[model samples]
Target: MTLLSDQMPCRYVPILAIRPAEMKALEELPEVDKDSMLPLILIRPWLSANTLSKSINRFKEAYGETRPWLADIDPFYAAALANDDDDDDEADPKKVFSEIEALQDPANGYSNWCAFIEADPRAIPCLRLDPNNINALTQEIITFSAMQRGICLRIPRAGFGGIGQIADILNAQNVTSVLFILDFEQATMNELSNAAAAIGLINTIKGKIPGAEIAISATTFPDSFNGLKEQAIAERGFFSLIKAQLGQFRLIYSDRGSARAEKRTGGGGLPPPRVDYPSFKNWYFFKPEKIPTYQAAAKAAMTHKSWEPKMKIWGTQMIERTAKGDPYAIVSPVRSTATRINLHLHHQLYFDDPPLALQEIEDDWVD
Candidate 1:
């Protein structure tokens, strides 16, 4: 029941927002890409009880197989919602409780996690080691570890100082095998100090929990592309630095699937018409200010050197169709997001491999 091993081709672990567009991207991923990566899906807080109920099923359907993956309710969102005293109907704490109950619950003695297990046994639950939640989380970890499915400890940048305490909790629960996700939400490696600090933390975690699998997760994707045309994929550079120092210590690569690390709040205006293409190191962004339409954006992207017509990727297919005036593929920010993410996933999975050729000949032909 090992989640990852030397024999597997698992290279990327994308931290995805559990939304329709992201789900569509996952659903459309090629089997080869799916085989090469694991997805750590974060359930956003805005979902209602009905949507929450459908999310796990959606995830299972999109994955198309009972493969190992991680699931966690957004801890920041959960904490904020739980502490909110406002009368906002959408931010109701009861709704948050229901959401928690559907995913993982400590209030009701992990009844929710048990039910979640019944729904998708392949899911590897993630726990955020918040001090306030540690007591409950310890019990949850014990329960999950007893199942022998493994547990993911999602440690935010701020949680590094508490590593000793976290190790004690794991030790007390007798949970030796674990997945540590060092999440740097909306943070980047623009500074050398940040990279050094991250490496140090990784070393500390490895020292505490020998042989534990670790993943470095972060995102530099901006919340708004305002007045911006391109952004470097800093997570790649950061991961590269860590890998250089660690050598072959089984550290997994993770990012936000080219989506913003921090969820944006408010703003009802339509998103700018843009299409983003991911290269080996940077994201080539296209936004047609004059035309202000997805068709124009797609057409503009086609002119970029990064756009490859021969690539059989789902995102490129959408862009090509839209550029050629396909109405079905043109319209809405949701479709645009899905297009970008699908491409990002493909690029990350095949970063070191050649592009998957589009099948043009019948395999049944006798030579």
Candidate 2:
């Protein structure tokens, strides 16, 4: 019943068409979405705000906590934001990890979005700092501190066409486990190659961090996932490239979809919604969950049972950074998913029809 096995403990599955303005939608999730144990979709900010943290908090407080967006599973992931990449002289992830912890001490409060639940059986509370203004040490320190506290860090490797500074943060953090996200909209043949080319990019720097598990995630595009398709069909030779060069069995971006993934419209909305390319239109790279047996049986209703996966795996070496910067991110105001931090969510749904026929039970069900 294992859909996939990778270094990271779970696969974060995202939902698509998440608007920044409508991020408050998180507050009204049904039982499933609110269940901290299940995977979640991130609704990012419409436009990168200078005060990203405050804006999101205000929205959530005004609305409500839609899902358990703030719970921690066995491992924790705290993501950070940065924009000035390819500067070469950036603080590492470890430094960023430290910086955030110091700021969140209740005395500093400089970490505009810093907050710790201070509860066990808790998923770490991630800080989505100001992408444009966050310091070099911000991400590095957060990663380091969170991991020391037994939390995994989820850092956005904003692929804005560069050998991003986030890599240094990733290297600096060097925790035992971490989650990395890339945007398909920003993904490029070069960035993917250069990123992997940077050794310890996939695995944490040696002697710096140990037992770190890496997972790559991306946002899906409107219609094409050809990059991933080639990788899956090819058994993802690019991932092999990372294992050979980067030396990690981590899940690459395409495995989760497009990292610099663009925005598209889903067909419906609300407690019951329909999406275009529903299967692959997730917004973020989420840890996957166990499907309920009944839910698994319900796959029959899916538009297409089979997907000719269009995923790409890129583990290339370093190169140039783009002018726009590669650190775009959006966090829902909700604290955590109902299923989080060591609490695995397994549910059952009944599908009357699926994208593929192999799952059909009886003709009556299909008709």
Candidate 3:
């Protein structure tokens, strides 16, 4: 199910976000039907505004005629779940709710509702999760609500866009959208090959989800190494293996440098001599598009899900990489020449012994 296997190239070109009547075009898509779909129903859990039945009815009415994607797609709303002041701007409590209201028209039926029931009873999920719960669900009525609607779930972040938590949330909230994250192409030092391979792995994850978009740029950085290489042969070897095994891939260099670098020069305490590792600026993506092999690699990405995808990596740094996969900067005298490679591997561990109960998404919403 990679984006492009000889048999699995994606027919879907770009990812689209719809609201209200904008969904009309989706209705005509053959994939809308349950029988034709690999998976039916597109969950817009992020749409928390239309929580009230009246608003939801309007939301449905807005897109009632044209959209087939969410025919019965019910969103997961957590008004009781308060957010922190530092939360993403797009995720502002009031904005999330108001947008839902904007979609309301009072014509169609509610998308279905789920009241949050917490374990502590008094410590309701909404009360703890959403800061604007009162303002959002202020007039929510109890009696007319239906259990068939849902239990309004919470998807905890995992540093990397909350992968796999979507399904977990659905199970908790009794909803159906299997939203999850599949990170592909998180740039590593001297790991272009592995980055490419990671994209393939991501494609594989996406292939499993009918309407999923890959969760991209979740952990990407500002290219801390500035296109630096590694000194360890073992690390490069591992990257090779990763590249070979990747199912789908897309990458953007990031700056998650919690690691330090030192030179073995005359000045032991001082920073090492200048190294000339190639840079792969992601400012202008799509070199992969020009190369048939790279294009194939992109198509080979076995993506099964989709998240807000982007190129957090810059576009100017990368030059024609060597066969060995080292990114060479396209510049005179190599900006940081004679630079010996030292790679610091960053890992995303789900279980790291001490036991973790909470997760947080780190990136800011672009819009």
Best by lDDT: 1
Q: In model 2, what is the error at residue 89, expressed in angstroms?
A: 35
Question: Model 1, stretches more than 4 Å misplaced?
Answer: 1-9, 45-51, 86-97, 101-111, 132-135, 188-193, 354-367
Residue-level lDDT tens digits of model 3 in 129-178: 12223223322212112222112212223223432333332333333322
* TM-scores, each model vs. reference: 0.87, 0.38, 0.24
Q: Per-residue lDDT tens digits of candidate 1, residues 1-367?
A: 5443431346788988777788888887776667668788877633454446566667777786657787777665676756767766576445445566355446644657655753666677776445567767676776777677777777777787887678777877777667788888787546422568887777887777786788888888777677877777888888887888878776788888888777678989887788887776778878988998889999988998877667766777788889988888857888888888888887776665644434332322110
Candidate 2 — which residues are off by over 4 angstroms? Answer: 1-8, 12-111, 116-123, 127-149, 152-185, 189-200, 203-207, 220-367
- Model 3 spans with C-alpha error above 4 angstroms: 1-21, 30-35, 38-113, 116-158, 161-179, 183-367
- Model 3 vs. true fold: TM: 0.24
Model 2, 1-367: lDDT tens per residue? 1111221343333322233323332233223323322232342322434333444364345234443332221111122323334445345433433433343333332333334333222233433433343463464346335534333334445433332454445455553443343322334444455444334444433334444434443322224322222222111233445556654444432332222234334755421111111222212112113532212212321223332222110000000011112221111111111111101111111111223212322212100
Which one is best on TM-score? 1
| Candidate 2 accuracy as lDDT | 0.30
The alpha-carbon RMSD values of the candidates against the true structure, listed in the order shown, are 4.2, 15.8, 18.5
